[model samples]
Target chain A: MGAPEPLPARFAPGARVQVRRADPPGHVRTPWYCRGHAGVIERICGSFANPEELAYNRDGLPAQPLYRVRFSCRELWQDYAGNAGDAVEIEIFQHWLEPA
Target chain B: MRSHHDMGGRPAGKCEPSEHEYELWEKRVDALMMLLSDKERQLLKVDELRRNIESLGADAYDRMGYYERWMHSICQTLIQRGVISIDELGRKMAELEARDGRA
Candidate 1:
């Protein structure tokens, strides 16, 4: 059988992106609250850990750098104050994001 | 007359337990209790979330984007709370696949 295909790495710092929330039974770091929500990448944290690898007993899998994403509270939460520019920073595993 | 069977319970076995032994026993029991309680709490949370999802009904579920957003939050919470380590969560997913007989 052919070797397993390497997982795709997408998105980079300063890129706008949205998280896709597939159902359970898959490894993903993007929180549900932020899925389908738009945000700008604040930093391209190095890839060192893959949540899928760690979740599947593959601790030895190459470390994938986690990105620190910044999402505006208003974008994520309805009824968020229009005047307040609140934001939340979350570390998302590489697979969680895709270009908006 | 001597009774054929001792009416009084035999004196409690007098094996003096050491302080270390007492501590070890206490720790073991506490760990077991915590593990059990943690599992129960995790199951309850999962159940609650599932019910909430179900109650939303199919159309609403998609409209609200329930699976994509809410599920991820629950998984993150589980990781944050230490109820399940990242590895354990992976194992669970693997098990589900195996059950479905998916290669």
Candidate 2:
């Protein structure tokens, strides 16, 4: 069989997106706290890792690009300090994000 | 030292009408106590779990991605057991978000 299809690269820096939580027994980069939450793409970190590669014993899963997403502290927390302008940056796999 | 007329203000009915009624009340109290104890135990367990998870450090945390997957499985299990409705699951998810300051 031909090599496995490369995972799709979806977003770029400055793009708005939402993270999705993929449930069940599989590797995923998205965290539960940020799942379904809207955030802005901060930086597109180059691809070198894929959770599926490690979770399942399949190194064939092509390397997928990762991204650094920034979400406002208030967006993620109820009691976040309003004046600090805090944000959370997480390295999420491309598949976790979609256009927002 | 009181006359029978002085008992007028007291409840005149039987303390327990039937053995069945007594048993039902006993069961109700037992259920309530069990629920309270369970709530306390779960709270402590959750706190400990959170601490253990957080103590893993940043690199180790990234390496271990099963916690969320496990939590999702827990939610599904609760739903299947009828302990929580779908709406309650959503609410619990929202609570998690709020805890992380995402909500």
Candidate 3:
């Protein structure tokens, strides 16, 4: 961790956001399940070195904000077997999200 | 490419959470990998390691056990980063096998 470089959060807590469904070839952290799904931003997980770049040994300079996005299980999986009330959460890099 | 590692929703089978004994080597493998991932070490990042594992061919990924997958990924990363060489590793393995009397 380095000195906190204040970066503006793109989405606010409780804001609706959608995960980009772009399946660009290469290493990515956004799981396939969450792709194209709309969810609520649970919280801003603060700025950190971008993992996508970090994987390539590149300094994740100008860290990006990560968000804990929450989605209903029923919404995420059409054939979801768990309770409809159940939800799936994933931490997504800000770059992958867009206002819904 | 969508690797087998991301098959979360695919219909595989029932969610039978089977409990099993952890082999000593498996435990050690986990610890060793984590140690290598320490900030001071920076030998590999978790995501980088994951991408390495995911990039494996489907046959290899499906055939490997959990810790076996970790072992393979760690070894591949070390080799790719030039931190170690396959020749050196193979030589060490041969020496160990010889010491163990495994012709």
lDDT by residue (tens digit), candidate 1, B9-97: 23346678644434554565444434433745433233333333344434555465423434544455456556679998899899998
Model 2 misplacement above 4 A:
A1-8, B1-103
Better of 1 and 3 by TM-score: 3
Local accuracy of candidate 3 as per-residue lDDT tens digits, B36-103:
88988988788778878888889999998989988898888889888999999999999999989964
RMSD of 3: 2.4
Ranking by lDDT: 3, 2, 1
- iRMS of candidate 1, one decimal? 24.0
Q: Per-chain TM-score of chain B, candidate 2? A: 0.30
Quick one: best TM-score, which candidate?
A: 3
Chain A TM-scores, one per candidate?
Answer: 0.75, 0.79, 0.88
Q: For residues A1-100, could you state the per-residue lDDT of candidate 3 as single tens digits? A: 6655756798899999999988886678898988999999999988888877877766676789999999999989788789877998899999999999
DockQ of each: 0.01, 0.01, 0.64
What would the per-residue lDDT of candidate 1 be over residues A1-100, giving only the tens digit for each residue?
6534444456777889877655454444455666677888888776564554444434424565567888888877777776567888887766667778
| Runs of candidate 1 exceeding 4 Å displacement | A1-9, B1-103
| Model 3 regions more than 4 Å off | A1-6, A79-84
User: What is the alpha-carbon lDDT for the whole of candidate 3?
Assistant: 0.87
> Which candidate, 1 or 3, has the higher lDDT?
3
